[model samples]
Target: MQGEDDLRGLAKIMGFMRAVSIILVIMHLYWFCYGFFAQRQWTLELINKILQNFNKTAGLFSHSLYSKLFAVLLLGLSCLGTKGVKNEKISWKKILIISSIGTVLFFFNSFLLKFPASGATSFYILSTGAGYILLMQAGVWISRLLTTNLMTDVFNNENESFQQETRLLYNEYSVNLPTKFYYHGNWHKGWINVVNPFRATIVLGTPGSGKSYAVVNNYIRQHIEKGFSMYIYDFKFDDLSTIAYNHLLKHSHSYRVKPKFYVINFDDPRRSHRCNPLNPEFMTDISDAYEAAYTIMLNLNRSWIQKQGDFFVESPIILLAAII
Candidate 1:
């Protein structure tokens, strides 16, 4: 209630300021055009004397620079009472443009440095009058823009968030992802299509973000169902490996050549099938031995990858290749 009263009082004060400014502007215009409004009967001696006193004041003349300046200042002050809103956004650039042009026109007493002839003040009045009205409106708009509640005014309809594509595309080798999204107050079904599964697609996410359960497992199951031969490198021995083993077992009939499931446990030799790395059955050329030796040494010491031509490095590699 106190705040409301304060606002009401401020509005009343602003109204008084506006009234005083307009009255002064009119008085100034009338005094400057005293000859134009001649031949009028004097109603009272005191009223005539009072108006005559103003005629002597230099600033009351329309041609005086201070006359327009005083009016502009008061109008600007009165604009402080302009009301602001929460949901609407005002364009400051437009307000500035209007106010600047109005200021220039309001101060214009002549056109192109040429003053009108005697008794031809009507055109000057019309131009400045239009300019005064524009200034009045622009001033109020600027005040309202400055006082607006920016937080809520800017977010009335959350337009900054980008629009996501919701169209679902499909192809012969595409992996489809089913989803649901929100729009216009209700949830709707959506799909993300990976059109070419043969092209490498990396699944990336933070821990517990469903990298395995939602995406990896789905891809494994679908690929198995499509009769794809997979070589899975599982970090968690049982997590993905177990899923692939069980899925392939169920979908084994889908493959033209029934694929066997083999488990290689490097930590437990008893659980792993014994195999020789230097087995001659798999080597087609001498380069195959060198490749095996290169991979072994690099895995043992990764820095050796940059030291390929070093004698100590090449010697061991050559020895390993001969043994293989």
Candidate 2:
């Protein structure tokens, strides 16, 4: 797992380097052209002339043609690089970091060293590096500004009730909530209420599509690290349950207040524990009796409730409620 993570990280870094290199290479080539020929004022006149003199005055090799071609190449590269980054898997954070590093390095090379610009390779290198860094930083800032503007518009367009609810939730939870959320190829914070603040979350996918691994690696991992008690129902091979048990054991050993771990596999009736969900001890009072019944009913009739509506499942729920 560690090796896999390392490889993933390396791949992301390599992608970042590829993106940075594209920008750098284009910038360097543009700088080389400018230094070699754009300095000549005759190049501008030749472009404006539209070859009226025909092949009389050095034709395309003249400074005018060379500079114009270079300019077009520079513009083309800029567009290509921008489009490439948009389609690539590179992250903004990596781009920003690399740009910042390049900017710093070029700043030192240009100002501290006081390098002479006599068409030396080092001079072009420093100049182009600085230019690329500045351009990329501007691009990053513009993208961020646009993203912020879009977010603001979305917030403004949202319903007042939704806004209020969001604010209320934010105010209600001041501390960071741990969650095992995956979004845009990144693992993000998922809200798992440790204090029985139940919120329904469902993960669905075809078999062998990493549904179990995602749950165990992300959600279960967070639960263990945060010391949250869990009632895991592992029906297939119990791989996730085993991983959770190992983590729980380690956590229990580390903490002063040892947490409990249980495996209530009903398949192996002899090995199964004697904890009953229907046990009255699990309920607080008559009010909780309905909830306990509803929980057990939902667990037992998952397929029925899923195929039929909750209204269809209401009868059994009410019956179990009264019986409990």
Candidate 3:
């Protein structure tokens, strides 16, 4: 309410200011062309005397062109409070472009009017002045045209809205994540497709966010169905292994070569497939023995992988390699 009242008050003041500006412009025009009028005896002596008195008293403002410029300046300032309307065509750039043309024409003709023998001086002055006035009014009209957008929060977030992918892409290794999302009005089905399983995939979610049940299990089942030979490091050994084993068992015919499932569980010896790292058949040199030692030690204590160059870590690994 207060803002609206303020705008109304400003508009009224601006209207008054514009009226004063127009009156000043008219006065300047009359004063400057007074000699032209007097030559034809169009103005009375009494009125001429009053104008002369005004010219003398105005001091620094005596110059007709300067006074007119000041009035034009005031008119521009008054345009600030003009109520604006919504207009699509007339932009600020266009307003400036046409106004600039008018400004040049008005000043050029104004300068030409000063020459005593200048031809068409009256016509030029009238034409340029009218053109300037029309351009200035166009600017005010633009102000009115722009006011319809005075809304506080009329933002369009629609530009950021986009079409979600509903079609699933397929390949030999692409793992599809079933996705359900609401966009616009309807629920759309999509896939968070991972094309290359070799690339590191980081799955992040809060506990109970279905990281295991929804996404992981689907990946295991899909890969098995596609006949991929995958080695899964199940943190919960049985949880993922069971899913992979069952899914693979159901889709065994898909693989061209028969694939075997293996489990290495230290917690329960009966549940694990026991194997010798330094089997005589595979070990041909000391390097094989060293590698077997490195793998065994790293698997026993994973931290040893990063501590390979350390003296204590290297000493134990070398000792194990010698024994093997």
Give candidate 2 misplaced runs (Cα > 4 Å): 1-206, 209-215, 218-226, 294-320
Q: TM-score rank, highest first?
A: 1, 3, 2
lDDT of 2 by residue, 6-58 (tens): 74676566456546455435433443344444555324554435443532463
TM-score of each: 0.52, 0.34, 0.48
Query: Where is model 1 more than 4 Å wrong at Cα?
Result: 1-172
Pairs that clash in candidate 2: 43-64, 179-190
Candidate 1, lDDT over the whole model = 0.74
Better of 1 and 2 by lDDT: 1
Q: Any residue pairs clashing in model 1, and if so which?
A: none
Candidate 1 vs 3: which has more TM-score:
1
lDDT of residue 57 for candidate 1: 74
RMSD of each: 17.2, 19.3, 17.6
Clashing pairs in 3: 84-143, 84-144, 84-147, 85-144, 85-145
Cα lDDT tens digits, model 1, 6-105, are: 8679989999999888876776555554444453541446755776676577435535556677888899899877564433545777888888888787
Q: After superposition, how far is residue 156 of candidate 2 from its true place, in Å?
A: 39
